[model samples]
Target: MFIIPAVDIKNGKCVQLVQGIPGTEQVVIENPEIVAKDWENKGASILHVINLDGAFGNKSKNLEVVEKILDTVSIPVQLGGGIRTVQDAMDLLDIGVEKVILGTMAVENPETVEELSNKYGSNRILVALDSKDSKVVIKGWMEKTEKNASELGVSLQKKGAGGILFTNVDVEGMMSGFDMDPLLELLNAVDIPVIYSGGVTSLMDIENLSKTKTFGVVIGSALYKGKIDFIDALKYQKIL
Candidate 1:
């Protein structure tokens, strides 16, 4: 599995939010591109970015930050949050982002997911299924839905989604290690690549996740808070 570092942007700074709560955020860096370049230099093949400000509204708040990162790194970047329309996805791709992740759009407008996947090709479109207690959450994990992550993953796969960014909302930003049981179950439920996110804490978790068939792993608070070393974790996962 690929060990991808996360850079969540809010108000142009890198921040980590506990359980997706806005009030529980802590800034990790003053300049996100500096951190993105550091991760890229450390051998990150892909970077995971989330626009926290955009997720809460329909605005794209972190475009400039994202553009800075794109200018700094050669590695592929997959971005999500506040991307609700086709033009939003197209604009990001036009700016050299490798993939655009659709979260709320996938749950709220399933047809748009299918349309974008078909028009842009599945490879450039990712469906983010963020869930808590088996219910998919939208609007930046602030609203719960009746759809379960697994069911949504399967549906997105059928709709031609390239992959699923499956995040466990209950464990996100907690540094308690990933809730792997649900991820494993999700892996069995869908044939598409599933990128595991939330609660990654140590090298052991990376080692364990590497043994699974998931496409990749997204590390946020664990990497930023010094709970784990990216180099050592990648070494343990046999990536470097």
Candidate 2:
């Protein structure tokens, strides 16, 4: 499985949020460009970049930082948060993001995802299904939806989403280890590539997740907290 390092940007700084809460954020690095370059040098295949400001409704707040990271890293960056329109996705793609991850838009405006997939091809479009108790959440995990994650996974795939980033919001940034049952269920429900996120605390968690058919796993708080060493974890995954 691919080991992707997450660089979540809030207020133009690289931060990690606990359970998607704003004030619960912990700044990991002052310069996101430096962090992106370091991760690239350490053998990260792809970097996961999220804009917390965008997720909270302030969409344009982090574009400058996002641009810096893109300019600094040679590796692909899969960006998420606040990408609500096809024009928004296109603008990012035009600026060199390898993939754009859609969560709220995927749930609220699947037609936009379809339009993007058709224009850019599905490989460049990823739909994020953030959930709690297997029900998908949107608007940065602040709003709960009646949609089941597994069902949504299949629906997004049908809409031409190249892949699914399945994040369990309950465990996100908790450093508490993952709940495998729900992850496994979502994996089983989707035929396309599925990237697992949330609650990865140790190399053991990666080892266990590797047993599943996930395309990749996003490591956030665990990496920032030193619970898991990025380079070492990549080596353990045989990704380096």
Candidate 3:
């Protein structure tokens, strides 16, 4: 499985949010391109970039920063946040994003998922199912929906999504380890690649995740805080 490092951009700086919260964001790196290149140099095959501003409803602020990161790294980058419209997805891809991750858009307008997948090929589209207590959350994880995550994974797969980025919000950024029950449910529910996010604490977490059928895992706080070494974790996952 791929060990993807997360580069969450907020206010034009690389930061990580606690449980995806706004005020709790801590800037880990002053320059996103530097962090992106460092990860690529350290053996990251893909980088997961998130626009915290866009996610919170200010979509236009981070495009320039994202552009610099893309220009700085040769490795593939999958971006999420504020990608609510087909135009938004296309604009990112047009600039160089390897894949566009849709969250609220998937829940609010699944037809756009189908349209983008058809136009860009399924490989270029990913649907993020961010959930709390197994029910899907959207609009920056502030609103909860009745839809179950596993069910949403299946639905997105049927709609031609290339993969699912399943994040369990309850343990996210806690450095406590992953919640495997809900993750496994989503894994079983979909045939497409499922990349897990949220609480990842140590190499043991990656080891446990590797035993499953997940496509990959996105590590943010753990990696930034040095609880887990990126290269060591990659070696354990046998990705490097």
The runs of at least 3 residues in candidate 3 whose Cα sits more than 4 Å from the true structure, single-residue gaps closed, are 238-240
* Model 3 local distance difference test score: 0.91
Candidate 1, residues 7-112, lDDT tens digits: the string is: 9998899999998888888655799999999999998989998888889894667889999999999999999988988788888988999999998887788887
Model 2, global lDDT:
0.90
From the highest lDDT down, the ranking of the candidates is: 3, 2, 1
Per-residue error for 141 in candidate 1, Å, reads 0.9
Candidate 1 vs candidate 2, TM-score winner: 2
How many steric clashes does model 3 contain? 0
Clashing pairs in 1: none
Q: How many clashing residue pairs are found in candidate 2? A: 0
Candidate 1 Cα RMSD (Å) = 1.6
Of 1 and 3, the candidate ahead on TM-score is 3
Compute the lDDT of residue 56 as modeled in candidate 2.
94
Ten contiguous residues with the weakest lDDT in model 3: 231-240
Ranking by TM-score: 3, 2, 1
Clashing pairs in 2: none
